[model samples]
Target: MTPTIPTRQPCPPGACICERERLVEIQGADLRILYLTRQEEKRLLDRLESLSSLSDLEHMQRRMFEQLGLRVTIVPSLNEVRSMRGIGINIDELPGLCRKTRQAIPAAIRRGLEKRPEIAYELLNANDLLRDA
Candidate 1:
């Protein structure tokens, strides 16, 4: 019996060859993930609505992208993440990421406190805030 080889599909019409190349390059970069808090998401949405100047909007987007530990040049904004998803990258894995992070939090917190006691204080304060609410 012979094994079948999968065929490569031709690029879609009107799509830039450079974009496919860019996606190939991005797949190799260190995966930087962001799980934004509700407050941060609200702030970004507000900024998205309020920014009228192109330069200002671009600046804010770059800042937000960097804050999320993503490459600003490769991913200029959250909107670009959605665009990447449309192109077939499996980036919508936040829920899975969150589940894994939650499972590892105890060990992470222990290591973090040993390295920096400030993290312990911050964690307690965060817990208190959540508990109070």
Candidate 2:
């Protein structure tokens, strides 16, 4: 007995491509690999691993996108991710992380703007004004 394969849903009107599993394709300009999560990643990996030539990889990437219902997301620079590995923090922690980093900077350097001295003075006055009120 043979297992039945699922049929793809028709592409939505006004959209160039059908949405599959909420998948969208993002391609990195230089990277040869398709970087996606879960089953899509698995399908692409299996296809890539079996390829014996560069042309085969290129053809397979295109074919996989069409047949497997996977989408791509392009990374502008993979270089940006190189230093960010294993820092197990979620998206919500980023702003607080940025604030902590700002706080860690040397106070003198952070304050060293000759053109912005008036702004600094204004901030200082505002602190005192708030304290008095």
Candidate 3:
């Protein structure tokens, strides 16, 4: 089933495309891959960095997953996981993550997640992409 793309809010004439839609689409067959723009990424990283406890992170995680279908796992260190694996954010690297630009965070996330068929299936199913298949 083809996923329904969300409509973007109206922008002023002559506005840049980036200012119109904050979600960046990455091509894939099995999953609808979307990621935040640089500005949005920085905002998210800043918010994550400000969390004072694990509960706060968990709350944010749930909200993000439910709202945007983005999965983020908190890890003590980035070295504990493979770079090309899941979207695991090292709590220690929040500042660095915020500094990454030119869609670097989103690109890394797409690379890490695109390889996992199960994740694709799960996300697709959750979004009801499989309902009419």
Candidate 4:
């Protein structure tokens, strides 16, 4: 058995923030992962409704492609991560890009303090969101 950590600090979403980017290079599938503080996460959802693209994964897909293997980014704003365009040389390098892309947001949200299933609809599944595929 292990002891539970006790602190006022909010728990992390405990997952990567996989927001796929636009089909910019078309080399291979691209993916971006990011880190966020709980405070930032809360503020993001609070201001979420203000963003039209917030609910649409397709619109955010472009960003994700650029953000593969990301670090030091905020979950809410997706700030401070380098783009994969420079890091990735070809499609094969982005192994499982599609799979990672799917788990990014919903998993992050699940680890969050609250999970909004209503607005989270688009965040749920790629089949439902990316119909053009």
Model 4, stretches more than 4 Å misplaced? 1-56, 69-106, 109-114, 122-133
- Residue pairs in candidate 1 whose N, alpha carbon or C atoms collide under 3 angstroms: none
Residue-level lDDT of model 4, residues 30-80, one tens digit each, is: 322223334444453344323333344333334434544422122321232
- Tell me, by TM-score, which candidate is best: 3
Ranking according to TM-score, highest score first: 3, 1, 2, 4
lDDT of 2 by residue, 44-73 (tens): 445544444434433654564464323322
Q: How many backbone clashes are present in model 2? A: 10
Instruction: Compute the lDDT of residue 41 as modeled in candidate 3.
Output: 57
The 10-residue segment of model 1 with minimum total lDDT is 87-96
Off by over 4 Å in 1: 1-35, 71-133
Cα displacement (Å) at residue 14, model 4: 22
Ranking by lDDT: 3, 1, 4, 2
TM value for model 3: 0.34
Over the stretch 1-133, how does candidate 3's per-residue lDDT look in tens digits?
A: 9996543334354533332233323333212223344456557656654554435546777876665455565432223323334333432211112223324544443443444445434444454545666
User: TM-scores for all candidates?
Assistant: 0.29, 0.25, 0.34, 0.23
Name the lDDT of candidate 1.
0.36
